[model samples]
Target: MSLEVPRPIDPSLHPLVTGNYRLATPAIEALYELVTRCLRYRIPGALIYGPPRIGKTRAIEYVRLLLARQHPRMSSYHAQCEHKPRHAEGPFFANLLEAVGDHAPHAGTSAAKRSRLLLRIREAAARSGSGTVLLFCDESQRYNENEYEWLRDVHDALDRQQIKLFTFLVGQQELLAQKTALQVAGKTQIVARLMVEELAFYGIRNAEDVATCLNGYDQTAYPEGSHWSFTRFYIPQAFDAGYRLVADSGTLWQAFEAAHHKASLPGSLEIPMIRIVKDVSDKSPF
Candidate 1:
């Protein structure tokens, strides 16, 4: 008997198919723990460094979303660092101010702008009903020594006002190398303060993590109570069209293993989250 290939489903109708699904993988759990530690212990800053395409930015966004749902009172700001030689702090703080809904004109010298930005951040945090503020900076490897020093100054200033400001620097491995260079060059204060906690993303490894990731799609349901699993869509579609790929055998688990293998890197069993998402979305007929 010939099996008919199932027609591809429209991506706009499903979260999993549209690449909008967020799986609570081990890396996400570790990120959550690091953020929780910083908030609980009143830590000033932390570092999350890893290779590119390893879901660092997505994990940060997930944490921010989770915080917004779990703790509505907490305020969070995200800024992307610019790639320029000797990047200054004005644009950085300007991004922060904009994230916090402040439209005040940033006019004055560097010192004056810094003072105004800090005051605006404090006021925004006060209005958020929680004295805790989280500032996440991506592409942090582009920051220069002067920018790091400015961050240290802001951390100190915010502390003096009794606002718990936690800054999370997310970047590649180069960030750690630059920080070490700074520490050796007698700029140990900011480096030391930010080293309170460190978290690294190594991608999803082991069978357990793969199963967890697969289960995320399998258990999730749409508005009509249909599952996100491939078996629930692909196999049924083929069967409904009077074709059967396997007769009551373990095809779902087989398909999962095959996809995992395809997603894994050469000479390594670990599969990055991005790769897994791409492989799954590409293979799903629905």
Candidate 2:
């Protein structure tokens, strides 16, 4: 990820993105691979995670497209986490029921929906073909205990169905550690069969509140004061309302980076300027 406005990286550019161009953006590609494997009965499942707007949703959308094109016989659905607190139980069952093709009309009672839900779940599994189902849950960090437990149960129910549903969970960095804790608490059996992939923050450094996209690390977050200098040096100033903002005007942010720890250098106050956003690419998240 980069902050420099000139070097923008647009995530919606295409249907297929090879990591060879992204340099350090391998996390999404790796998560995409794991989901592909899960569809083919290779892995039990995998999760996709990162800071918000860091490309988690983009990865899932790409994978879903690939799977639909190549497989053509699987079911796919996406569920967003609740913004407010909720018992995971109802939503979990309802989602699973929908996934299996139950599509139950809204009901006031879970018990009333149970029979048809199980029927659909069983029927989807009994398709007697190379059929699979995938559920991609975004913003999963909001999942409370109820949601977490419901997730565990869903894993179990899917296993019993033999539907080979691949679940890709997308969430914050805490989701990783939280999953481990939940599994250890004996709330889940899918833990043994599940694997957590790592997506290190190769981007998002050398900045505060995110000036550029996920370019490099911020100058602050650690000792490299050169980061403050680097961002100031590389990122051009913003011009607005007849006011020309220069790199020197970045003094406060530079100091912020320095406090995080980077010592920048002084540059010419009257350096030649260039307008070059189009010339730059694959740097900042636009």
Candidate 3:
């Protein structure tokens, strides 16, 4: 008789692997809906703002995945904004080039970089079969008016080519403040171009929300085709005995609510996605 060796578990299947895994929560569903509308209407720009650690970035990723699946012919790219003490046109275009996977991003002048950006984006849109592209900018709160002006130039250049560029800004609440500041400064051109639509991201708001998120762990499979879910992977015996994470949602919500009261925290009890995921991931049947 031949002895068989068991396959090693994939580390990515673990809940703590963070970016490697994502659960489709209600907030993500809302964000996806907004993005879908923006693309459907060919909206120039939209803003997604939320408090820090509220899963905005993750939501962006999830939405991107959904968009790719639903609109297979669309092109999408994600770029993270850097806080420069002083914004320059060269660095601005260079950042976009890098985000779009340009080679020799630093080998050109600002004008040349801008040209490259336009060409790359145009080519991408052309190849997408839909003639449209989505640009998601994270940490967009760091962008200044000048940076926006340069971005607007890119948008205009692409528009001239008949390629639709839908820019979505994902950042903290300061993004809203920046939009207000721009409006007050009479920079309506930029506002009209990019900030015409806005959506607020939120954390788990109630026991029902908690249950929905927990249900993802209880039902989502690991290794793409395996029967083992996150909950099952962590507690196989209990899982086989019919235990599920969704059953604990009410208890988790009650504990957090009580803790908020004990600490005298203000406002309604809203738990960040990171905190909720960490709380659940840290627990074990043992």
Going through the candidates in the order shown, the clash numbers are 0, 16, 0
Q: After superposition, how far is residue 35 of candidate 2 from its true place, in Å?
A: 1.4
Measured with C-alpha atoms, the lDDT of residue 25 in candidate 3 is 79
TM-score of each: 0.77, 0.54, 0.89
- In terms of lDDT, the best-performing candidate is 3
State model 3's lDDT. 0.85
Candidate 2 vs candidate 3: which has greater TM-score?
3
- For model 3, residues 1-286, the per-residue Cα lDDT tens digits are 1113232375444545644777877888888888889877878899999998888888888888888889999999898899898899988888899888899877789999999999888788777767788899999999999999998888888888888888999999999999999999999999988998999989999999999999999888776578878777777667789999899999989999999999999998888787887787666432
Each model's lDDT comes to 0.72, 0.49, 0.85
lDDT tens digits by residue: candidate 2, 1-286: 3554532333343111222122122444466667765656655556555656555655566566666777776666666665764564556567556645565634536655555555565565466354466777777667666665555555566668665655666778877886788678875544444434434322223322123322322221112332232233334352222222223334533544564434344531211001111112334334
Error of 3 at 182 (Å): 2.4
Ranking by TM-score: 3, 1, 2
Candidates, ranked, lDDT: 3, 1, 2
- Indicate the worst ten consecutive residues by lDDT in candidate 1: 244-253
- After superposition, the stretches of candidate 2 with alpha carbons farther than 4 Å from their true spots are 1-26, 95-105, 112-128, 188-190, 193-286
Clashing pairs in 1: none
- Output the worst ten-in-a-row residue range by lDDT, candidate 3: 1-10
